[model samples]
Target: MTELPFATTRKLGLVIDLDTCVGCHACVVSCKGWNTENYGVPLSDQDPFGATPSGTFLNRVHSYEVQPDHGAAQLIHFPKSCLHCEDAPCVTVCPTGASYKRAEDGIVLVNEEACIGCSLCAWACPYGARELDQAAGVMKKCTLCVDRIYNENLPEEDRVPACVRTCPSGARHFGDLGDAESDVSVLVAKRGGFDLMPEQGTKPVNKYLPPRLKDVAPQIDILAPFLEPVSKGPKGFLGWLDRALSALPGEDR
Candidate 1:
């Protein structure tokens, strides 16, 4: 049995801003392009350019419709990938030691050679980050561009995750979550960043900046009542954490 680490020395991950994401597929495209050849095994592909396109990518963007308490309905572009939890359930659940989280930088990865494609990791992850590669017959997830980030051959400025580099809107950020003074951490503090499904106890290193609703001017009219979000009841513990961290405005937050 593989023993898990009680605590990671450093946690590195991405911070996605819902307020700025434009739903552009640039991150998705750039990830696929860079990772395809960087790793020995090219990511599997299936009719990527065809009318019905399909392919493997480390990063993905999804759109959701939400009516905030501030104003009218809105479309939120959500970018999701491996959160690289401090205590990754997927790594703990790997039967064949295929999944492991690095201690030095807290990047979770899979040893494809040891993976049996049992899919236990997939079942263990609540974020839907893991995917089975039909071509390799193994489970794979985001590696946070580990190869590029650490490659000495690449120029320092070019050593960020492909997704982060290609994000035209600068909605995606990458940094060390373990370092309290890191830019990403400062942003989280000021913008009220939060973990996804914190109740699940993954303690996801990645944080998401909530949508800034202040941009939409609050209206005082009968129609505003209908637009008020029913889901605005209570933000749960994450909300409390946000308040404790700082009192950033809803829009700037």
Candidate 2:
């Protein structure tokens, strides 16, 4: 079985804003495209064109219609991936030492070469973040796009995770959560970001910003005065036409 490090030098994770996500699945598509092409193995599909198509994906979005106590129902788009917990149960449960967390940066990853296709990690994960690749017969989860973020060939701006880069609504943010002054940390502090399922004690690195409640009836209502009319009557070409029409017989002045 694998053992987690006592501490990591940095905690790199995502801060997702629930209020801005539009459930467009751009993140999902980008993740699939990047991971399949560059990562360990291509994510496979079974019966893609058939009635029941199933495939491996590293990121997925779930939408829930939630009704606040005082407001109308709202649809929340939730994107789910590996949380890379500080005390990752998936790591401790791995029998072959394939699943491990990085000591330099707290990113959980699976060593595909060492993996024996055991489903233990998937079972241990509470977030349902792991998926067994049907073609490869190995468990796969999100790596936080480690290859892209640290690659020197890619442009600086493109160093973020594919999901973060492709998010149309700017809902996904990636940074060092460990740093108190980091942008992600500041956003989390300002938005009251929270862990998913805190009771699990996994100490997930990723934080989610809660959706701000929609405004109900206004407590005070004040109407603005109507704007004065711009002109009392037509004053240009329309004025000349009006004068000509008024001079004609039987024309109302």
Cα lDDT of all candidates, in order? 0.86, 0.93
* Model 1: CA > 4 A from native: 49-52, 216-253
Instruction: For residues 1-253, write the lDDT of model 1, one tens digit per residue.
Output: 3446767787889999999999998998888788778763677887777888766667789999997676578899999999998868999999898789887888999988898999999999999998888687888788899998998999997788999998999999999988999999999999999999999998999999998855644556968766857775348897787676676655543
The lDDT leader among the candidates is 2
* Model number with the top TM-score: 2
Evaluated at residue 38, the lDDT of candidate 2 is 88
In candidate 2, stretches whose alpha carbon ends up further than 4 angstroms from where it belongs are 217-253
Q: How many backbone clashes are present in model 1?
A: 0
For each candidate, what TM-score against the reference? Answer: 0.82, 0.85
Error of 2 at 160 (Å): 0.6
Model 2's C-alpha root-mean-square deviation from the true structure amounts to 6.6
Which ten contiguous residues of candidate 1 have the minimum total lDDT? Answer: 244-253
